[model samples]
Target: MSRLTDLIAQAKERDLELGRELEREFKVLSARRSFGLNFERHRPENVELPGRPLRKGDKVRVLPPRGSTTKGDQRLWKVLRIESENGMRLARLELIGVADPESASVAVDDLVVVAEFRDYIYPGLVSTGKVERGGDKPFHTVINGENFYALEALTYTHRGRIDAIYIDPPYNSGASDWKYNNNYVGEDDLYRHSKWLAFMERRLLVARQLLKPSGALIVTIDEHEVRRLGLLLEQTLEGFTIQQVTIVINPKGVTQGYLSRVEEYAFFCFGPECKIYPGDDDLLTSKDSTTSDDGYSRPRWKGLLRSGDEAERKDREQMFYPIWINPKTKRILKAGKYLPLGEEPDFNVKDEEGNVAVWPVRKDLTLGRWGIGVYTFNDLVKKGYVSLGAYDKKRKSWGLSYLSEQLRKEIDEGTLVVLGRDPNTGVADVVYEGAATRKVRTVWHRTSHDAGAYGTDLVGKLLGNGRAFPFPKSLYAVEDALRIIIRGKPDAVVLDFFSGSGTTAHAVMRLNRQDGGRRQSICVTNNEVRSSEQYALKAENLRPGDEEWERHGICEYITKPRIAAAITGRTPDDQVIDGDYKFTDTFPIADGFEENAEFFTLTYETPVSVSHNRAFARIAPLLWMRAGSKGRRIETLPDEGWEVVDTYGLLVNLDKSAAFCQAVGSNGTIGIVYIVTDDDRRFQSVVRHLPDAVEPVRLYESYLNNFRFSMGR
Candidate 1:
């Protein structure tokens, strides 16, 4: 074996040994698990609190039996121990700070986790009453809530339908950029990496279930956690092709300590059969200034000599040949015979002055092959597809160039093309067809992707003078990344769980406006109050959880307002800021998008128990979202809370089941109806009255099966 191959094998063996040693050490520490990473940490299950089995140390407010205690007699107690008696869990409690008080036993149901009842409520949407011009278009959604729970709610509606997901998650740079459970996790925290990993793992697992089999997930991160996030994604999303692309967001790098970091990473994890769609932005094209007699620039020239792998005569011996040419005019005359290795052929071509001309060969007389074989070269030459360049004294030979007939014809036809011009000579060096496009490279350094100009300045202009978000991504960069994946699939559904400033939604709307496609975006972000906002709110004695503080969060005050401004062609202050959009250069800045979007804040459903009868009302918005959030639900008596989508109606109230079915039967397009009734017999009876083309489905049954959770007794 070659020395390099041997060295690689030895390195591989050493790596295997190191891996085994690490495995053995982990096994010795009892950290090895069967299927996944084992951190050897205890994490309690997130359950509905205040009922069923209660753990020790839980606080309780005790009330006397019906007639024994007055309204003012109740006192708070703390659970000391929990034990099972007669198949019932009981808690031993002691009154707080009561001197010499005897401990009392009570049923586990009497005790509740502190402030846990408020969590039992389901999340609901509070519309901000702001929608843009296109009321008839599919509504792009910006959900204001904790993404974990928001994603859980979306599972009920958008499962397996999302076409692409682009998320710019926190880099965990220890800069107080992100918060976990309402508290910022700093760099010095012991479980910082673990917490971030766990947080992303949970969300990514859910996000995976939401992607179509042909969809892709694009995630952006910095060097701080790129490797960790990559491993986490590989472990969580197995059997997928994952590629990491380096994007130069900052050309002038940000200096940390020694090195200036200019690049971040994007991890693209795609399902089988998913391929990136090349965009026209980076395509090679001709310039307008370089016009020839035919109104098009001269065709570009390519070196006829092959250089890499197969350039040597031994690789493809038949490609080694000569072409007879006039020395002065630099025009091809005829083909010459091919010479085998260690053989030489004399070229005795004479110019008009009778001077013997030399063939185009390397200075050292090495036999290099042409780019194509003899027959291909002959065909190209016959079709005027070859160009002979001026002789070079230093190289001791003339340079042969090749041109395709299609390119020549395009040049003659005056097609708009991209031409590379020389600064000194003012000569067009090469020309390319305008229609030609190329795949985007891993490294993107386009000026349009500048975060400072496009992200901060543009967003600042839209939201007001002050910076609305810190280090927001460039809209054009996000749009370009998305366009690469969803170009042909224009009607695709996009999702961004960590939609910081709702840039993804804006890009989607802009894309739809550009292509007249009906693409929709679902953006989920928590209305977490930033530190700056918190300080401002503190001046007014308003803290988190206060109505005023909640209204001024990142989602409500920034994300939603920015989206509204982009759609309405005005700034947040109502000033018209309309013009040509700088990014994409295809749409007007203030064109007032012919698209529509809704702003919603997630709130919880009251009364913890979501019963079958009330389930429809609780999940009606979810059904509307599933139906593409097109038209509003009909809430009158004859309709009585029915959501219609084309010919399909989601029957929420079946009070007048027969009348609803009869009305649906009159409409020939109403082929399918989802009736929300718990009774199977009633559902079957309702189906009996439906039209022949219409099919009946039980909405409540499916809802219950999809969203079954533990409710404390």
Candidate 2:
């Protein structure tokens, strides 16, 4: 009937066994469904790494002369050496990846570092600045570099340790929002969708390695590519359950031809061990119904009797029970034993003090089962969990309800307000204020999630400019999404590769302030100037690494300044922000968060340049991060044999193993010790003297091995 069937039939005419094998193969291929999203995997992307000064042995690209109409050479070049002539620096360069390489002498300032995605690069981190509010808490880090490279580097230090990752990637909305292979994939490009998929696939594969077994990945996107993204995530992240939630980011919709788009999607991908935690905000209901006088929400109760199929007494024998209540006062007294099959409870039975027995009976007169068994019901009733409501005439019994375990948790956490006991039910009447905790619904609609009011406006207040960044996510929305996964884990390590304006890190700090958590955030963003600004800068003869060009880039102008202002409670010019945070906690902007953060620019390093004393400063932060990011960091190889901080220790001089061992043993707070030595036997010998609680790490080898294997394409 079909082409495949006909081909199999023709093969069968020649050889029966061959045809059978062909049929089996064809069936397996058919099971691989495409669902319309299919494309060829393109070549790896290339990005220009700016800001770092040009030096010998670095791969670079030459920029054209000022006001020149012709384009500069596009071929990759390696710097041979730098020579100063007539008070001007000249770089000797040679073309790379070609048979007959050409060499030329050019101005050192004319070159910028350029890297291909498939190239292996030994990465380094260079600290730019740091801000400390107070305390010895772990520092939140923002790395100014391409996210793909940063993610690859994180695999070495934080593989399988991150608790949650929330990324707001580009929507691929046929604009200059994103780039592929050093060029923006505009609307006119027919292969834009394929390029977007290719870019995401590479980063997601590496990101998957960073999450713990129970970690979660939350990605936000608009309607432009929601369908394709969903399919890509499913195909790439196998074995992980994926669910999407619709959030009304902009109540006033942006018109797209016939439809006014008002909502975006968040796809949460997590393993089976992960669950959507309950929160106090029930977005499905109106704000007035959920919030109370105390800013919390009222407690919700459900019927204690089971409903629907398999709810009859015969279906669950142990759940068939009766609750005794005071007929006049309507107060629940206690629960009775579960009746056996075909056994009917005496509805007329009365206990001492005129307490009447109430059986779980359906309106159709069929015997129904209680949601909980006898022992559990009795325990809950004593804790004021059970309640009696108005009599149901059809069932000939009073309506009964009880708080589930989740609601009880909310009460214990003080998110729900217990106003007073009902005179009739004799059970606590609870109401949820604004900040109650409950399981989130599929659709989310709230004032706090509004982008224009909360997201864009809040950034304006903090940064002193309303248009500092385009289309940032609402602070509350990002915070709530993170809370669902990381509320229970106070020290969660969160990573956001597509960190536009450092909102993810700001959200993490807010969460820490609310619960005194020491959670840390790692944000990666580039310092690319906006397209409109880039054209203007080019007209002025400035290049990517120029001071004027770099200052206006996203990372320098927006992400970095926004994060610092949030931590210090002062703008870049040291002026106090003039506003108060509404809803949720409601605190003044002047009252800064109690948090610490450091800024670093990603550096591409060669293997030969990473020798012990040469690269210690660049590698110190990685060790600090791996050792829980707390305590004083050793920035260089100490003159002494070893250096011991609060949380980690380092021994650069292996010859003084005796002294290093004494220092490490004396420090009770040390958890990880880095021993710099090439000999494995000598390293292990000194490790024996250290306390068993201290984990010994072999230096240079331990760090280099991570990149040696990971750097290959």
Q: In model 2, what lDDT does residue 438 have?
A: 53
- RMSD (Cα, Å) for all candidates, in order, is 15.6, 13.8
Tens digit of per-residue lDDT, candidate 1, span 527-643: 777875565566675544557767787887789888988888888778887446774555557776778888776654433234434433445556567767665643222245554
Candidate 2 has what TM-score?
0.75
Q: What is the Cα-based lDDT of residue 586 in candidate 2?
A: 84
Q: Which ten residues in a row have the lowest lDDT in candidate 1?
A: 41-50
For model 1, the superposed segments whose C-alpha errors exceed 4 Å read 1-122, 281-435, 465-467, 606-618, 635-648, 652-655, 665-672, 685-697, 709-713
Question: In candidate 2, residue 56 scores what lDDT?
Answer: 70
Question: What digit string (tens of lDDT, one per residue) describes model 2 on residues 1-713?
Answer: 33357668878878999999999998887678766556546667778877667767877888788655344767789999999999999999999865578999888777877787767867889898989984888999999999999998898789899999999999998879988866777999887887888888889998998988899999999887899999988987888989999999988999999989889999999865776666666665534235456665665587888898889888999988878888887888888887888776887788778888888898788888888889989998887889888877677677898888777776777656577887666688777643555567779988889998878888888898544788899998999899889988888999999999999999999989888899999999999889867766777888778789899989899999999999989888788999987776889987889899999998877666675457778888888888887868888888886888889989888888888788888888888999888899999899989999998999788777787764323
